[model samples]
Target chain A: MKAFISKNKWTLLLLIAATALMLVLAQKTYYALIIALFGIYAIVATSLDVLFGYTGQISLGHAGLFAIGAYSSALLTIKFGVPSLLSLVLGSAITALIGALIAIPASKLVKHFLSLLMIAFGQIIYLIINSWTEVTGGSLGIMNIPYLNVFGFEVNSNLKGAIVIWVILAIVLLVKHRIIRSRVGNAFIAIRENTVAARGLGIDVQKYKVLAFAVSAAMTGLAGGLYAFLRGFISPETFNGTQSVLFMTMLLFGGITTLAGPVIGAIVLLLFKEVFQTFSTYQGLIYALFMLLVLFFFPNGIIGLYKSGKTAVMKLLSKRAEATRNGGAENAEN
Target chain B: MLKIDHVSMVFGGLTANNDVCAEVHKGEIFGLIGPNGAGKTTLFNVISGFYKPTAGKVIFNGEEIQGKLSNQIAQKGIARTYQNINLFKKMTVLENVLVGCHTQTRANIFDAIFNTKRSRAEHEEAIRRCREVLEFMGIGHLEDSLAGSLPYGDQRRLEIARALVSNPKLLLLDEPAAGMNLTEKDILTDTILKIRDLGYTVLIVEHNMKLVMKVCDRICVLNHGNKLAEGTPEEIQNNPDVIKAYLGGAK
Candidate 1:
């Protein structure tokens, strides 16, 4: 129990903090909705980190994958009369399959070519959703998507949605943490740091790259499925290139390769955007400037900044302790 | 255990290795030595499956392995270090070695996600093996430190440790003694011999003649991408062609 707590202290603390925030904002329906939205976006950012941060691959087409999940789930529930939970699973699984297919070609390419391919992929998906008026409802997306039902209880309220989303997010984060510390996660990092060395050491780089893509897509797809249920609607506009870029931005802003980075990044950036909605025209400019500033100052992201700050404080404390010890020795000699 | 049969690697008008042929018998320390631009590293690349040879075959344990992917070749029990230290710098030394254990362990995504008993056991076993290898390389205490933070010699040893953890049949060391002091070189020589004593074949490429002569049971010389000499160290040392190639003339 002691070892478990020590290992999971941060996770425990985050859960407590989230629960407290939920209680404090219990009466504010708008804030609760925003928090729920943050949970969804945070899931996307964390999924992106699995590829971009750990595996050192880029995908600007995540918005497309997200759209696939949302549409599939919404359509399944509305048209096929499938249960909400089953649709969510099926939708994410479909996204995972598509992600693996994309990775087959993407894994063979490197750097700029990979990024360009992803951009084209996103554009293609967006175009399909935009023009396919028959099934996707075209620009006019499907509405009144059913809310998630758990054991016959309807998650219709924002508070209940937030609870469900956070629970899922917590599980995602825990699973990610386990994988990162495991042998499989090591292979991902090995590919990221040095592909040649990784290959020489017997790691199947191509296979792992595809695995990273599939896993990342599955998580992002889950987020999209949850988003559709929470908002009761999702349009192609919500999963455009700009939205994809926003997910990347959140990952970068929070810091990549760290679990806390994505959640903090999603919550902070979403809140910031909400606050700046009054100046809607300049919101993009303001966001860009803020990202630039953060990148310039903290290249590793906010978590990195916190880490370095912590080390600095620890260093100062150690130095003070050493100085006091030396002074005491001198007084004894006197 | 390994044969380089008429291997020739040509890169767009430049012959990095021309008709290079050599054989490494199992459990012996084989050395490939030459001056700069002599294609020693290129030949290592060919053997390790980094570059498919323009011509010829690389046979290991009686099976031809040319043109195969590097990871496939590695899975066939051939591990190699780089001329330049290639380590996952940001990762801890233990993590770096654990990656080398990838082929040995087999817990899939489902196992990792669910934290199954098999995954936990495999993980613990991998860690134990990594620790054992680090201890062998004399870096057991530094396992928690980042690979990038180690001193130059330790980084080199860490690379060797990473390679060794994979439990390859043939170990290739590229300039293992490069950038090392005389004492470190002596230690490396001992380590190489010890590795050989453990029934593993070693193929080394080095510029340090003294260490090569001291450690290698046999040496092959390359000049201008062609084989100049292949013999016991004493035979290579006495050969006029080898001396002329090294000194640019027979003195």
Candidate 2:
């Protein structure tokens, strides 16, 4: 129990802080909804990190998977009268299956070809979502999606919705933490670092690659399901190829492999999106320039900058301590 | 035991290995030595399941494993190291070796996510074995360091440690002492001998004849994709064909 506490102290602290913030912002419905959206985006970005960051597989098709989750859940709740919670899980699972199917062929390709395949996948899904009038309601989209109901509690208010989403996000983060520290995560990193070496060590490179995709898709799908329930609507406009690119950008801007990087990236970028809402036309250009600046100055992302800054501070502190100690010794001798 | 039965690998018109046949006994340090382009590494690739030999069978423990995938071959108790160092550069030394334990561990994504009793046991067992192998390789102290950050010699040892943690019956080492100094080579020689003593049948492809001669129980000399000679170190030293093809007819 003590070991678990020590290992998960930071996670616990973060959860507490996020819950406190949510309670404080409970009266501000707009801000609460934005925080809920941040939670959703953070989940998607972290899932993308699992694929691109840990497994070294670039996927620009996550928005498609997200659409699948959102559409599946919305349809299940609206048409079939299924419970909201069950639909969310089933939707995520369905997306995971599709992700594994996509990975079967994608695993055979490398670099830009893989990226192209993922882009094509996202485009196809977007087109389907836009044109499938009977099911997806065409470009008009599906509306009046039910709010998430957890057993007896209805997450109708923005603050309650944010709390619930953040709770799910906490669970996702905890699960990700477990997997990353385990042998399965080790296999993913090995495959990323050196395929030949990983094979030599008896790791099934293709199997792990596909698994990464499936796991990533499952998490991203959950985020999509959450988004659908939170906003009570589903649309093709939100799950376009550009959104996929945005997910990747968030992963890169925060840091790829680290757990906290994606969350940080999602929150910061979402804040930027809100700040630049007035200049919507220039948002793309500004994001592109920001990404360029980040790539140049902090290639490893914001986490990398923080780490380096920490080390610099430590170095200066040690140097000052050493100089003072030497002066004290000289004075005593004199 | 491993038996390479008439194995041949041809890349288009280039015949890398032409009907090469050899037998490696249990718990013996077998050596394959040849000058440049002798198909020694090619033969290693064939046995390790990186390539489907054009013809012939690679039988490990009496099962034909030539056409199987590399990971499948590894599952059948065959583990190999590359000619170039292939340690996961960004991963810590412990993590690199832990990856070797993948074939032995049975924890899946569900197991890992839930931290089930089975997963916890497997993880602890893997770490225990990894630490043992790192200690055996004299790299226990450097387990937390990045594999890429290690010095060249230590990286080589870490690769061996990674291979060793798999607990394979047959260990295939391709040029283990490729870029080592004399002292490092001497240490490697001792490590190889220690590995052999640990009851693993080691098939090593090496250019360092001194290290090979000192540690190999039996050495096979290849020249231009053909077996030139096969014998103990003294017998290989005196064979006229081996002397002419490999030793340059000098000593």
Candidate 3:
């Protein structure tokens, strides 16, 4: 048992078992849909962490990337008669280019200035969707988008779609995880700590900052593409500044610096979205209140609490064991 | 070798460095001593490419490096430590040293993204180098400790270790012994000489007269950004201008 834990063999086994369980559930039941949603949101949040948490740069324009991917894929496939897979690929690629272009100038701005610029960028995306009636169908939105079919397998059911999303999310998460734990990740942390010190250490801080922005943008764009096809429709209202704020809230609530924080955050938040569905109008305010509570108490977010709790539990258990042994010794001596 | 030739820097009306010229030979423990605001630090900054001279040039190993960025200069084999230790406070000591070794590592984005065998090798190599550098500075035991939480003396030593990880040919140390007590300063003086013995040239800016006189092969005295004297320590200590600079006015 010690060897298994020490060598990470047990952890690997647990992960494989969990994945197999998820796959079986995905094939048999609707539970995988929830996991799929969690997986997609996690991928987006992790990508955001690379920008805000690691690089120490914040963005309020992520929903723009998401909306762009959705709109591009939905519009290209439905209206232009492009294949679903081709549309997904082309939409994300185009979104990535657009993201890079926006990030270039966006990186030059700092703090509130950059945030204001991103908000404006997001608004522009919203306006484009609403105003361009010829292409996007304006505020009415487009629907009945075709399902993704690969080698005669149609992604028509929620379970199958969930599987597809989860697989792609897994690939993205792995790639992003490796990137963040790499030299570039170290450079990002350096930039976060002190840009001047980073510069002094012979790091090209600006280049890495821009690269981080681009990579994150690409990932968010990909998420957007997946979302569009999954929903088979997307609207201008879905890509607003309010949605971007929700994404930020998700990142913050999950734990900004943690890899799995986003998953926890997104799942909880989305579940709340469902739980509060009856009082739909009050959901936003409730969410804001919940976030404030998290911020006030768990300022480091969910992961922080988890870590501190784990330490506290371990300390308590050790103390209890020590007290028991000492008590036993005292009794014996008596 | 570093040569600062007739470098003059004027900030608006005040000339910070007025045609200051100096030569730091390879592998010499050179010292720059001056009273407060004497521009000794400014000189060190200029040589390390943190500041651009208004006129003249700094030639490092026969390459003109005046007006380049500090990071670029560091890449060109010059490393520095601040008088006020600029460590990454939140990072572990090992991570801080790895940050210093950043420029030397040649791992590309793809290598890092994929965690390739080469990248893993480089990562291990970087960790090994960081360990060696920390051990050399006698702070290897504090590798996992946060840099900000370390005691002041150890933090200073950590800064020096981090600077060494860059494999610099010339090291610019700004007041390494400034705030240490007599006993601590004695240990630091030994440390400075040990560093000099390791085939690296050290140019130090210090106000600790005892440390300056003890370790420096030659000393340059400055008063209000102007050179008062430049000679061996004994010559510097006895020069009328040096005496005037340190003790108000020489009789």
TM-score of each: 0.97, 0.97, 0.92
Judge the docking of candidate 3 as incorrect, acceptable, medium or high.
medium
Off by over 4 Å in 3: A1-34, A75-90, A149-153
- Candidate 2 structure quality by residue, lDDT tens digits, A159-250: 98888988898899898888888888988888889998888777889999999999999999999999999999888999997788788888
Runs with alpha carbons beyond 4 Å of true place in candidate 2? A1-19, B247-251
Among residues 3 or more apart in sequence or in different chains, the pairs in candidate 1 whose N, CA or C atoms overlap within 3 Å are: none
Higher-ranked by lDDT: 1 or 3: 1
- Candidate 2 — which pairs collide? none
B159 in model 1: Cα distance from truth in Å? 1.1
- CA displacement after TM-score superposition, residue A29 of candidate 2 (Å): 0.5
lDDT of 3 at A67: 84
Quality of model 3 by C-alpha lDDT? 0.84
Taking all chains together, the TM-score of candidate 3 against the true structure is 0.92
Question: Which candidate should be chosen as best, given lDDT against the real structure?
Answer: 1
